[model samples]
Target: MKSPVRVMLIIILIILVVAGGTVATAMYLKHHRHQAATAATATHQLSAKEAAALQVSLPQMTTNLQTSGLIQFTVTLQADKKATKNELTLMQSQIEDSINQIMRQYTPDQLRNDKGLNSLKQTILKSVNHMLPTGSVTNIYFSQVLVQ
Candidate 1:
């Protein structure tokens, strides 16, 4: 025969178990409600806006050489995207000025050399990027290079 005290202890244990189960269920429901709200908010969030800007264009460079003064020679160059076209265009004048300065510094022989042209291309692009906070000249194109 169980003592009265033991019976009371058993009843208390069952009650505690029931209480724990109730608390766990409440906590679970609360967490799920928060998760659902978060999911709904995420679904309503807007996506990022695409950049509708133009890619930077590299200006073509050609040089007239006094050393090879017989005629003018051409060296075509280009750059990859460092910034948008508008950004590049905004700094176009400054970039152009850099190119002219570079050309003026080089002689006919150095201008004719392919290595020299590449070097000039990098320098011009770097200078353009410096002038425009938002854009860079990525390529140097010589669409109509007349080395006469």
Candidate 2:
């Protein structure tokens, strides 16, 4: 029993409401997409030059094997970047001296342990760093270790 004009008005109002909602959703989606793009751009990260400067080289080593006293075990040691090229040339002798002093105390049995070897590597890094002018040997690598 509603009037025809009233029914038409109600339908027009409903259409207007639905259209408003669609416009608001499209605006929100556009804004959120832009925000997401900016966040991705902000996350582009880089490291400092000093942090990247440390270079590691793997050097092989030979150790006397436990059995028969004649066999040898070989290992590779990774060396970190020294303060300078001169430090690398001269530091090896002093670092070798320090390592020899510490290693002489450990028997073949102690060296057999994986954790012990890692600790030993750290120890060598520490000792070598102390002798460098810059006071840091970033790391050590063991590429090919042979124990005989």
lDDT of 1 at 146: 49
Which tens-of-lDDT digit does each residue in 45-144 have in candidate 1?
2222222233443455455454454223332223223245655566566666666666666665664668876776677667665776653444555444
**So what's the TM-score on candidate 1?**
0.44
User: Candidate 1 local accuracy as lDDT?
Assistant: 0.57
- Most lDDT-accurate candidate: 2
Query: Per-residue lDDT for 33-55 in model 2, tens only?
Result: 99999999757443455434544
TM per model?
Answer: 0.44, 0.46
TM-score of 2: 0.46
Q: What is the model-wide C-alpha lDDT for candidate 2?
A: 0.59
